[model samples]
Target: MFTLFYVLSLAIACSAVSVDVSDATNRIANGAVAANLQFPYAVSIQRIANNTQVSTRGHRCGGALVTLQHVLTAASCMFEWNADGTRTPITIGNYRVFAGAYLLSNDTATERVRNIAQYVVHPNYLGIPSYVGDLAVVTLSTAFASSTATPLSLPANNYNPADFTDCVVAGWGAATAASQTGANVEQKYANKYIYNQQECTSVYNALQGLPNILPTMVCAVSYDIVSSSCHGDEGNALVCGNTLTGILALHSNCAATSYPEIYTRVSNYTDWVRPIVSLANSFTSGASVLLLLTLIQMTFANLLS
Candidate 1:
């Protein structure tokens, strides 16, 4: 995931006003938010400190409400450690829809922000050693408030990776004009070039200098000029032909061309995902227990009466 300071320092500026989808396609400036994005699938996350208050002002990353109860995001977003070794609280809901000034119709377009009841980072994800296993699932206290809001797309049961030849990556990271933060985070769809492990490792060989890039990671290069994940775009979705197959996680670095943007292969983590989603349902099941208890109490009261 790109850091707030570094991504903000870049010079990729785009206006926040309504932009033509054509201009956004070409990447004339920086990028544009989706014109008629019926379901706002992406969410802007806010981190809060142990004081149980919003602290550590930082960049907003993207995520998907895969189920009514679970959210998928880049593990790096939660790996940040405090002196006490505790992770911060992540805020999710329609409240974040305000990010790109697309709030006029938010009543119908946004996912209601919900607090995470629990979270699970891929056990193998090494916080520092390698950021590759950078996937995590957040179970919200309640299922997201849904309307016409887009739901998370699940990886096809037996989908072929090679089939995803091209895709559009969208986010609201820092714009290029160094000092000016764009009015809202925007989306720009880019033509992506899928990179095989051997190829991507070779391209980014200078950094890791090893052929260790795993098949679990997918790399994509953008045809749109000045288009790439920057600060604040971490954990966004890489929608390939409308089917979201990956969660934006890493790249050589934010705004780097030689290094392709990397994502957490959704298919690779499906097994680990099953259990986390199961736990999310437990919260709802607890409510069922409460209802049962209430019923029993009512019967007892009737007998006493």
Candidate 2:
């Protein structure tokens, strides 16, 4: 019975995809939170191009709306190509800014109003051979509404890595039975920050034989075997204690055994994130000035008319 159980665990971990649990559910790991939980900004995304649209059935990832316009997410979730190898366009926005659900599993999420003004992926993101450290930003069509629960929270300027010694990961991902391909199902799991780069290198190699975990990433594991976030959970936020710390970039093949999920450390990439944010701010200021001038011109024209 012991040998059979071990083999079954490894097999489930090696499965390439994950499906959401509808009938039975496991006790979610790291599911604890403070009495009054503060919510981070959530952004919904879609893939499209000039004249074509892509499927959005499982098109949800947690994000932070840094400025009035910019929404940040893991680049791994957005990077894709067609048969011709052309870049695919991505659409991103706050809950009401676009038409989608926040928790995603919640019904009655069909309220599409605002459109995306621009979408920007980190140019430095390296995909294959190095599946870690993928991050990006999206500019929305307008400022988010202040009255909503989707307001952006500031990233901890100097995040204490120790704070995340044990953190929580929330997403609309499969509870178990690896293979993150299915209808959106929101779930949350608590995971302990197992170790840093040094340990991750050893753990990943021993488990999956991968190398160079990279300074831009961190590793996390759920002590509970049946409790975890899977594939579609990519790009979701890893809440360290109470502060939003990093973005869930990828896991070791869905739910590979003893292998922890890797995330793009937002704090580590602060240098890289600054420039992208600056560009968005500059664009916003320029547009604000342009709008002021246009309003003045329209007023003069109306006086003349």
Candidate 3:
């Protein structure tokens, strides 16, 4: 975690906004408080420290449940790349996912907590300072039985982010640019629109050390761009219509206008994610052969993308 200082510093420099890298759980910037069960797929990925269930302090990243056992999030949530271009992964046991949790304190009856069994960061993920291939699929220690939490629907094979409309981003990121301190207990969400890819690229590229936006990444913003997603929202889902089309890779200054947020397009990685969720769900269905064939098909689609 100490090595992340360099990466966090780089991000701060690029945004020209003060960012407190200490606690990961934060409030949404100028967004509405979400109704309970409204986003049953929203999950809080918190690093275990102190008595967690009711405690209000810890590092956390936002994520969505893609399956009872698998979660889709950003690689930046699980690993950190060093200045030397090497890497370090957070211990699997250090963090846990809380699904069906709208409020941070006392919602255990509705919340399903799970320890992470393992995770798969995209093979091409370059970690922070680079948002390319930022997605990761995390497997839970055990699958949840019928619960209040629901798995978010993944994008279609032909899902095009350019066609994305009526999207929403939900998280516990800070509400103001001035706050890099304190704790936020409830989840919040904001309506967003797909921002122009080329335009977004130009804006960030102007920042000296930032990486170029790739085709695999999608950009989004509020109607007025001033109210946007913030730092601690990393790894949360960007749902458009009824499908999960984006996984937040890097957030913009929530208090700044015109700078849009970026996410790794879920459509670009559907091929990689499909098999994991499908195979796990099909193991007891006696359809291994058909599943293998479908996996091969998705592989081709990903290659073409």
Candidate 4:
């Protein structure tokens, strides 16, 4: 089982404000501060030093809460590539998840912090240059209280990507490509339009010399060049009408003038995800059984004494 920890005195003072969803959708460039409770399913995957206090630093990636105890993200976020082009899984000790976090600088009392119990990456995923099957499920040590946050639903098997044009991507990643120094303290979000896969493939192949966009990937472009997901946004969610549609994969260049961003098509892998989620629940069930057995053993010992 994983252990939970807390970071104290990090909350900042900020007034909650309201935003019009339509206006937000039409806006262009650099994204905007997300409204409080705007994205209850968004989560921050943070990396902390061993034996150190939790700080605002070390945010590794972003993800979406897909179940009470599971977060969906890119498999690349959980592994490191070596000089020899081989990959190694990252240790669980270096990470934690913060759910219902609107502002990292101002973590509210309701936000939930959880340690990762275990994670499963797609079997076909290899490192860079070929990010096919780039998805993973992060199981939390403990489930989040229902009152604290609700999990986002995955797209149905019959769901068609072309039917949804307006979409939103949210994360604590760099707000702009020009400023990649630090991630936003508060969650930032922007609107993007799903683009034709052929057009997206043409752009990437011509510019970056990369392979054609795979069937397992989806492409989206910002209304303009200035607003797009950048560094630190990896593994974030591409949500359409509250349904998780994709996982952030790659972009030609952060806020590029021509290239569109690529995401792992979640709709294409519902079969792979559903079973892993069921497996995650078994971990919780096993933990409960162990606890009960320990309690009963203690009770019998006391009776003999």
- Tens-digit lDDT string for candidate 1 (173-273): 54442323322334444556565656565544434322245767777767654566555556767767667678776532334343466687887887778
Clashing residue pairs found in predicted model 3: 26-172, 26-173, 27-173, 27-174
Steric clash pairs (candidate 1)? 11-176, 12-176, 13-176, 92-113, 93-112, 93-113, 94-113
User: For each candidate, what TM-score against the reference?
Assistant: 0.68, 0.67, 0.79, 0.78
In model 2, the Cα lDDT at residue 243 comes to 57
Candidate 4, position 293, lDDT: 87
lDDT of all the models against the reference?
0.54, 0.53, 0.73, 0.69
Residue 70 in model 2: shift from native, Å? 2.5
TM-score of 2: 0.67
How far residue 193's Cα lies from its native spot in candidate 2, in Å, is 3.0
lDDT of 4 by residue, 1-305 (tens): 01111001001100110111101111113777788768888887877546552432456788899997999998888875465556678788777788765766544343478889889999988657667898999999899888777888878866656833888988776544344233336778878778788766655554332445887889886765567665667788988767788998774234334346789999988889998898667647566868878999999999999
lDDT of 3 by residue, 118-208 (tens): 7888899876567678888888877766565788777876787564377998888777656656553677888888877876676666566
2 versus 4: better lDDT goes to? 4
Better lDDT candidate (1, 2): 1
Q: What is the Cα-based lDDT of residue 144 in candidate 2?
A: 58
